[model samples]
Target: MKKILYAIIPILAFSIIFLNMFFGHLVFESETQEVINKYSVYVHLLSEWQSESKNIIFDVTNTWYKSDKIRNTNHVFDAESKEYNSNQLHEINGKSYVELKHEFSDCQEEWQPMLYRKAVDTVRHEIEYVQGQQLSTDPSVSVYPDTENENYDNSEQQSKIKNGFVQFFPICTSKDTTSYNFSVKTDNKDLGFDVYFVSSSDQRENFVNSKFDYYTESGCYGQNKQSYSGTCHDIKKDSGLLVIFPDDLKPWTTKVTVNLYENN
Candidate 1:
């Protein structure tokens, strides 16, 4: 009986190991196929949207390094996505502008401006300045209006808002990563400070009403920190992060650094 038990134990161990390997392989394949299917759907919708806007969302300077290096990224699942998501900053006519689109990649190349935060810019009173008008030289300061401020009204800088043709492109962050570094620099100082626009009923009415697919949000139009909730065509259901910043960047000949990290 002892001899039989010993032989049976070895056989059971081998069988268990074999089953795990087989099932694990199937699970991986299943997940991959699911992503591929979702990718197909995204390509269809985004491709159509991309056509409407013309192939060029915004012309940004592209940079290529000889050696592709990875750091603080071993655990990041969507490393490739982060790599493609990096922005291209360039100086044209002394104005700094980063193209507003996802960098071209095997997934898809398109631009849909997602980040929105209230910003303060000094316009020579003639050009038009909103009520919240004030000049600040600090990038670290928090200028975003508090949602709970009952006195909050976009009227501070009310004027004829410039409407640009934009669509829905989500700034996706992976579950494996911690946070994001959505910033750019010229001459090593943060864009004279970063300005942003957020999706408030009053702020992103243009975005929601634009040619974007139907957006269902949990928050009202003017609600602070809300997103137009939904997925592209068939991509996996996931959350989006908008890296909003100022558009009025003063251009300089500085070597800019655009990086994405697991945390800010």
Candidate 2:
């Protein structure tokens, strides 16, 4: 009887732990996001970027990404409010480009205008930020409404808050260019059913699959299981660096330092 009891204890523990881990990934399946603005930054080639002479300017003033739960039938929890606002700087042959700069701010505050310089040198290879020309004047830009309580609940219904860290988990990390399709078909359990790839051409494809690691100055946040903590992630390869956020922590107004790298 004692041996049977001991066996049952292990089984119960496994079940409970597995259930929690599984629950961490649960909210993603039912999530439906409306990407107001998204673009790809090609990081593999450095030589091509250095030779660029065109002066790239902002196309749109503000771009954001937000996700909502389609399964919220009662409309209890407010729409998942997560966004990163940045200017779109395009790379054209006639343009003179310099630094790839980034700034972090939340929804309520007046974000500072990010400054860019033409003189730059770096340790890594190279990267170019593709942006839309209509950023400031674009009529499609939508404002994300605030919620009554910004605090998230800790319950079984809560899943991992990716914190805008979504990566292509398939073959994109292995090569310079990888083409895969995400279908919104409910029957396919491997690929998610919430977000579907709508762009048919690779040039217009806003979704980029790369791995990254993030950290804050105060050590408030660091690398997750899915991210690479080394000098470089999936630089020239396809979906190599899979960045993941903390499962236990909910969204609070916090800032993080994002690093970009390329190979020599």
What TM-score against the true fold does each predicted structure earn? 0.23, 0.20
Local accuracy of candidate 2 as per-residue lDDT tens digits, 83-201: 23233333322322232323223221122121111112111112211122111231222111111112333231124322222222222222353322111111111111112122122
lDDT at position 154, candidate 1: 34
Candidate 2, position 82, lDDT: 26
Cα error, residue 227 of model 1, in Å, equals 22
Scanning candidate 2 in windows of ten residues, the lowest lDDT window is 184-193
- What local lDDT score does residue 1 receive in model 1, on the 0 to 100 scale? 100
Tens digit of lDDT per residue, candidate 1, span 1-264? 999999999999887666544442232222111111011001111222212212222212111111222332222234456554455453321333344334333222121111111011122221222333212233222122212212223332111112222212223323322222222222323222211222222223333244322224322122211111111221222322222222222233223222111221
Q: What is residue 222's positional error in candidate 2, in angstroms?
A: 9.2
Q: After superposition, how far is residue 7 of candidate 2 from its true place, in Å?
A: 84
CA lDDT of each candidate?
0.26, 0.25
User: Model 1, residue 30: what's the lDDT?
Assistant: 25
